[model samples]
Target: MSRRRRKSLPAEPVRCVIERLSHDGRGIAHQNGKTQFVDGALPGETVMAKVVGSRSKFDELRTLEVLEPVAERVTPPCEFADLCGGCSLQHMAGDAQIAFKEKTLREHFAHFGGIEPEHWEPPMRSPDLGYRRKARLGVRFVPKRDSVLVGFREKRNSFLTDIDRCVVMDPRIGDRITDLRAMLYTLQAHDSIAQVEVACGDDAAALVFRNMEPLGSADYERLVAFGKAHDLHIYLQPKGPDTVHRIWPEQGEERLSYRLDDFDLTLKFHPMDFTQVNAGINHKMVALAVEWLDVQPGERVLDLFCGLGNFTLPLARRAGQVVGVEGDDAMVVRGRENARLNDLDNVSFHGANLQGDFTGESWAREGFDKILIDPPRSGAEEVCEYLTAFGARRIVYVSCNPATLARDAGVLVAKGYRLVRAGVMDMFPHTTHVESIALFERK
Candidate 1:
């Protein structure tokens, strides 16, 4: 059988007026009943957009020229904002971005769950720029250019965005992009470097280089020297995540930690462990969830999908006991370690497949009156099935994906919980991703 040839997009830029915004931060335009998702075009804006990709139902486009500008549109701060995929909504004003996210959250709730929150909490915003603390940057050396490319991928393209500096990333790594590229270009294994994983704490920042092959002694020495000069921790991963090992300063400590000043607690984790990308937003988010859950002194709280005890340790300070359940045994150990470090005897960490039937587990049998969930983008639909059994009077859900959150909210409502308050968090500002929290009480 012969394969069908893909259709080519028109060459000339087409004029259109953006009708609204798509969930992914694209401008939605209708032309002859076919929708167009135009990048860099805000809602209510008239622009000439060039077609990039097309299909029978919808089309993809990029703004070539804006004939009319919208009130919310602003000059993007980053120079490479047009080419880099680091942030999609940088052109939209900060306040407008938050409003769009709030609108998206409400639409998700109404469309998916057929329910709305009784109250909408004011959005928690990050007050500063360059707040990102974690990222995985792609690294590649192009022989044709005889230079290295170090940054995020191009917008809507698989090719790496050849960017020198990033305004959204933390200064620790963002400011060093050009320097890193120069250093990598001088290394013998420059082409072998796959990517660099970045993680930062209040006092320290670390870079983990993923190498496809073994590095020469001179290259290894250079990487270590670079780390020493910058006062940054250096790690190397020759194969899988488990192969990540530190090389700089022969390190006294293998982990990085951030402090929750409000709670006077510090949590530590390995450089490769799961952590929030934005430290400031994370601190505020934990406090917000704790406040909404309303944990009493003698209450037992359950924190599902708890990683490294971010929320568990904090909640343990107020609740009589807090049980943190996670699927990864390594994180469970980390959670226990953090609890011990904090000297919180009331909190315990357990390892269990949250998607499976784990109510028979010893930790689940304890019965929690208050609950908190901070699941990944997949959300916690499977665990919602067992929430009613836990008999928790109040549940606080911190979600990264609004669609999944709305779906799980429906399940919670069906299980006798009413969504009382919900709001969006500017955890990842300038991006389309929405981090929201919802409070559900037993009806």
Candidate 2:
């Protein structure tokens, strides 16, 4: 059987006035009965867009030229923002980006949850740029260019963007992209190096190089020298997660920590462990959660999906007893380690699959006065079903995806909870990723 070829796109740029922004930040316009999703075009602006993709219902186009610009549009902070996939909304102003995210969350709440908060909390924001603390940079030695590239992939394509710096990432790593490329190009195992994973703490940063093959002595020494000169920690992964081991600063523990000054707690984590990418926003989010929970003395609190005790430890400081339950056994161990490091004996961390019924377990038997949940993108539908069983009066939920959060909100509302206040957070700026927090009180 012969495969059908995709229909060709129009070569001439079509003039269209963008009607509005899509959920993912693309501009939507309608020509005749077919819809057009144009990149790099804003609402209320006219642009000439060329079709890059086509479908029976809608067309995909890239802005060829802007005939009229909107006030919300601005020069992107990063030079490569238009090409790199790392940031999608860089052309939009900072305040406008937050407004778009808030609008996105509101729509999600209305569509999926079928309810709205009694009060819309003001958005919790951080620095609009230069705040990313964790990233996995794509590395490749392009044979055609005979050069090594280190940065994010190009928008709508898998090819790595030839960017020298990333303005959105923390300066320690973003500003050194060119330097990283130069160093890797000089190494014998340049082609063998697949990617680099970066994780940063308050005082230090670490880079984990994923090497597809073994590195020679000369290449290894060069890596160490680079680490020493730049005052950065170096790690190498030969095969898998277990093969990741540190090489530089042959001394202290293989751990980096960020301090929560408000709670007087220091949390340590491994380079590969899951940590929040925005440090400042995390600090504010945690504090806000603790305050909203109103953990009175002698009250028992339950923290679900706790990782490294980011919220659990702080809640532990306020409540008499706090139980942190996580799906990952590794994170449970990491949480316990942080508890000991902070000298807090009031908290206990346990490992359990949150997607199933763990209600009969000992952790669930203790009724909680207050609860905090920070689930992943899937949100906490299964857990929300049994939240009433815990006898918690107030619940604070931190969510990375607004759609799932809204979907889970319906389950919670049916279980007799009112969404008192909800708001967006600038956890990831210059991108369409929406992070939100909500407070629930027993209705």
Candidate 3:
């Protein structure tokens, strides 16, 4: 017998004032001795929310009415902002969002790290819409709606949103959302299609479709014709990610690639590989970070969490020697390949789990003059502590989470490093996601 279904809890209407915006862009409010997270609310605003889901400690709600509006709030440009779940903070003005992100970074650093930057670089801003180069789109058939949903998940739900377009995604993907819906609908294996992963480069855009079953010959022909018509490289994943294979009219190139002209670098990535979603700002960020590192010929540099050598190869152009370390061996191998393609022998790779303490002499064995660390959201507390002990003269840290960055900055300051400067990069544009870079010097 099939497993029984779990009934969803009924929603309750409640009125509250949004106190702040969380990192994920959810509005935070407290009511009736409990914390509530509501979507589509701005800080310093009164609103009625319908509690949709609840955990042991907190409840997630949808804003039912805006009783009092905040000055920072603005109408979102995207038609599907509320329903698509692609962006949650779109209603917040761009400037106000940047200010909040900067404030968040400072507060996190002070609270977690017990130190603050002596100087702050202004928040970087860019085009807010159509900025994303990569995204994962869900595929769902809603019988009640009598339509197929080909977009992100619904607000706070696993079910796919019924969307015809997405404004935040790159035009390559957003423009094709409706076409994708139609194409899947025409396929004999429509119910078997699950999702599509999109990745775009300067020259090409690729889409990888996740399917529950193998494609029939007719299904394959339809996909090939579609790829030819759209000039898209289509890959099909019949099972796991490892099973992904191109199923277009032609084999095309084996990999998708992006170019960085500032450092004369070209990085190739698999559809599932981790590359910065915003290519334009990523180049600018690289320039800013390299300028701060001030690499000189014959200087030694260490690049940590170096995925596919995004920063390592660029540093290699200026530094005499650069060592890139990452936890994933596949990334390390790819990084090496990129270095070979660029014909830059100055950079090398090492595989290591960077989140652990580097107390072992072997871990701190490298004699480097400068260090560049771009850690994940967990922050670089362990690595920062190791940096203090290793005594690198200059350290440039790139972070996606301010709270974690602040926490790690405290460790560096305690270890005799001064945060000289920091700034936010609007890599995600309209979204509340914060990407920041900080400089520290051994005092």
TM-score for all models, in order of appearance: 0.98, 0.98, 0.91
Error of 3 at 150 (Å): 1.1
Candidate 3 lDDT, 43-84, residue by residue in tens: 899998887887778888888788999898888888778766
Clashing pairs in 2: none
Model 2 lDDT tens row, 1-443: 99998787788999989999998888999997999998888999999999888889999888878899999999988888877999889989989999999999999999974689999989889897779999999999988899999999888889899999888888888889889999999999999999999999998899999999999999999999988988889999999998999999789989989999999999999999999999999999999999989999899999999998999999998999999999999899999999999999999999998998888888778789999999999899999998999889999999999999999988999999999989999999999999999999998
Which parts of model 3 are misplaced by more than 4 Å?
1-13, 29-35, 54-59, 144-146, 355-366
Per model, how many backbone clashes are there? 0, 0, 2
Q: Which portions of model 1 show Cα errors greater than 4 Å?
A: 1-3
Q: Give lDDT for model 1.
A: 0.92
The C-alpha local distance difference test score for the whole of candidate 2 amounts to 0.93
lDDT of each: 0.92, 0.93, 0.84
Per-residue CA lDDT of model 1 for 1-443, tens digit only, reads: 99998887899999989999999899999998899999999988999999999989999999999999988999998988887898899999999999999999999999994789999999989954689898989999999999999999989988999999888888988999998999899999999998999999989999999999999999999999999888889999999888999999694879999999889899999989999988888989999999999889999999999999999999999999999999999999999999989899999899889897788898888788999999989998999999899899999999999999999999999999999999999988999889999999998
Which 10 residues in a row give candidate 2 its minimum summed lDDT? 357-366
